[model samples]
Target: MLFQVGGQGTRPTFFEMAAAQQLPASLRAALTYSIGVLALRRPFLHKVLDYEDEFFALLMMILEGHSLRTTDASFSESLYGLRRRAVKIAVNKDNTQMDSGDRLRLSGLEKHQKVLSVAFLVVLPYFKSKLHSIYNKQREAALQATLWGNDDASFGDVDYFDGGETSVARRGLLDPEASNWTRIRKRIEAIIGVCYPWLHAGNEGMTFAYQLLYLLDATGFYSPGLHALGIHVCRATEQELMDTSSRIARIRSRERERLRGPPWLKALQRVLLSCIYTTLDYAQTGLIAAVFFFKMMEWWYQSAEERMSAPTVYPPPPPPPPPKVAKEGIPLPPDRTICPLCSQKRANPSVVVVSGFVFCYTCIFKYISQYKRCPVTLIPATVDQIRRLFHDM
Candidate 1:
C-alpha cells in the first residue's frame, strides 16, 4: 500500500531477503548452544543463561545500532547489500495518491522511523516468546489436573463416590481439578480469546497481503517487522556504499601521480587494493562457511567410532617377581654324590652353568628343558647350559 506504483531501481530478490533473516536465526541458535555449554564451567553464567532473551536483546541492540549508525542498515541487511529507508507518500493536485517514482529518491529514514524500526525488530520476538511460554504452562497445568488431581487431593476411591448422591459427588470430583490457579488461568484465557483475535488476524492478514504485493512489483518489504514499521529494504547504490579503501586509494593515487613514483610501486598498490576488495566481498560468506565446517568437525569427532578408537595409556607390568631365587644351592645329604633334584643317588651326573648346581642327567635335562631355570638357585638356565660330568667309579 505504501508504494502502489512502480518500484525503485533493482529490488532485491525474495531469496536474498529470506537468507538475510536466516543468518540471524542461525546465529541465535548457535549462541544458545554455546552459552549452555559454558554455563557448566562458570557459575555466574547461569544467571546470564536464565535471562537469555534479555541478554540477546541487548546484544542485538548494540550490533544493530552500530550498523545503522554507520551504514543505515542492520547487520544482516548490510551483508546482503541492502539498506532501510522510510516510505515516502505524496498527494496529487486532486487529493489522489501519486506514483512512487519520486518517493524512491528520498534521502534516508526519519528520526521516528529509525527508533520505531529498531524497537520493533528487538521487542516483537521477545513478546511473542513470552506469550507462547505462558500458553504452554497453562496447558501443562490443565493436563496435570486431569491426570493426577484425584490422587494429589487425597481421594479414597472413585467407586466410593459413585454410590452416594451421584450428582453432588460428581460435582465435587470436578472441584478438586479446578484449583484457584487453574480457575484464574481459565478466566484470563477466556477474556483474551474473546477480544484479541481481531488484532492478531489483522497483523497476519497484512503480512500475507504484503507478500502478494512484493510478487507484483517488489513494492512492499519482505520482512514482517519492516512492513509493520512502515520501512522497506532497498538495494544500496554504489555511491551510498562507497568503500573506505577506495577513497584512500584515490588520495594515494593523486600523490603517486604528483610525485611520479616508480612503476613497481603503482603496481603493488593496485595488487593490495584488489586483495582488500576481494577479502571484504567474501568475508560474510567465508564466516558462515567456517561456522558450518567447525560444527561438522565437532559432530564427526563425537561419533562412536572416534570414541572407540581413542588411545588410552596404561602402566607397564611389574617386573617378573624376582624369579624366586634361593641363596644357597639345593640342600645335599652327608653323601655328596646324591642328586638334589630327584633326591636319589647320583647317576650320569650333570652340572648347570648358571647356578653351579649338580643333578642327575635326566632330571636336570627335563627340568632345564621344561622350566628353563636352575632347580636349586632359581637362576635363569637353559638346556644348552647343562654339562655332563665324568668321574672314576
Candidate 2:
C-alpha cells in the first residue's frame, strides 16, 4: 500500500509509508529488531533526524537571497513579495486555505518582518510630508489675510453715476438680519453638510481640504486658529461629533458667499456654474422637468380657498371652438364600435386611451395591473371605468 500527501498521485517515501501503516505483530517484532541493529551500525543517522531544523535552514538561505534582491525596493514591492510567498506556502501546506491559523513557512515569517519594517519607514514619512504641506498652506493663507488687513484693503469702490450732488443723502441698502455674507454662508454650509462628515470620518480628508481652500478663495478671509482646530479634530478623532463640527465649519465658509445673491438666482447660478450642481439636480430639475412639475402639483388637490389664492392657472382657454363641425355634411358610420364591457354598439366605444394606444375594457383591466394608465397616451384611467366595462360585459 502507498500513502500520498493530500491525495495527490505522488506516493510517499518508504519510511513515510511505514510510519503511516499499522504493522502485524510478527512484522513489528522483526522491524524493531532490524531498527536496533541498524541504529548501532549507523549512529549518525539518529543525530541528523531533525526534519524541522533542516527545513528551516533551507528556508533561511532562500530568504537571505531574497532580502539582498529587495534591499533598496519600495514598501509595496517588499510587501508584495512577502504576501506572494506567504500565500503560496500557505496554499501548499494547508491546501488552498487562507485562514489566519495556517502555519507560515520560515521564509514567510521573515518576509512579514521585512514588510512591516518597510511600511513604517515608507508610509509614515509620506504621511508626515503631506501633513507638513497642509500646515504650510494654511499658514500662508493666514499670513496673506493679515497682510491684506494691515494694508486696509477694501472691495473696489462703487461709483454712483446719478451725479446730482445737491446734498443727496445715500442710505446704504444693508440688511443686518440677512446680509449677503450670512446668506451665502448658510447656503454653503448646507452644501458642505455631506462633505464635512466625510472629512471628519477620515474617508475624505483630501476632499475636505480642497473645499476649505475653495472657501478661502470665495470668502477672501482665513482663521488660522479655527483651521488648525479643525485639522486637529479631524485627525485626532473618528467620532460623529468631531465629524459634525468639521462639517459645520466647512458649511459656514460656503454659505458666507451664498448670501450675496437672491436665493433663486443663487440656486440658478449653482446650477449653471458647476458640473457638480448639474450632476446633483439633473433628474429633479433639468431634462426631467415635466416629471418634477407633475410631482409638484399640489395645486391639483388644493382646497377651494387655496386654489383661489394661487397666483397662476393652467391650460388657458382655446382660441374659439374649431368652427363647429357641420353634422349634415359628415357621413354616419355603418355602426358604432361595440362597447365590449357594456355589449352596446355605440358611436364611440369609450376608448381607453393610454400611451397613444386604445384597448378594450377587459384587456385594459388586465394591463392596468402591470401599468398605471392607458398604454397609448399614458393617461390615468379610473377603476370605475374598468368596473363599468366589466358590468356591461
For each candidate in turn, the TM-score is 0.50, 0.15
Worst 10 residues of 1 by lDDT: 1-10
RMSD score of candidate 2 (Å): 35.6
Candidate 1 clashes: the total is: 0
Residue-wise C-alpha lDDT for candidate 2, range 56-174, written one tens digit per residue: 23332333333322332221122122111211224445456666655434122245444443333334334444444445554565587777643212354243243322212332244
Report, for every candidate in turn, its global Cα lDDT versus the true structure: 0.68, 0.38
Best by TM-score: 1
- Could you say which candidate leads in lDDT? 1
Clash counts per candidate, in order, are: 0, 26
Score candidate 2 by lDDT.
0.38
Q: Show the colliding residue pairs in model 1.
A: none
lDDT of 2 at 53: 36
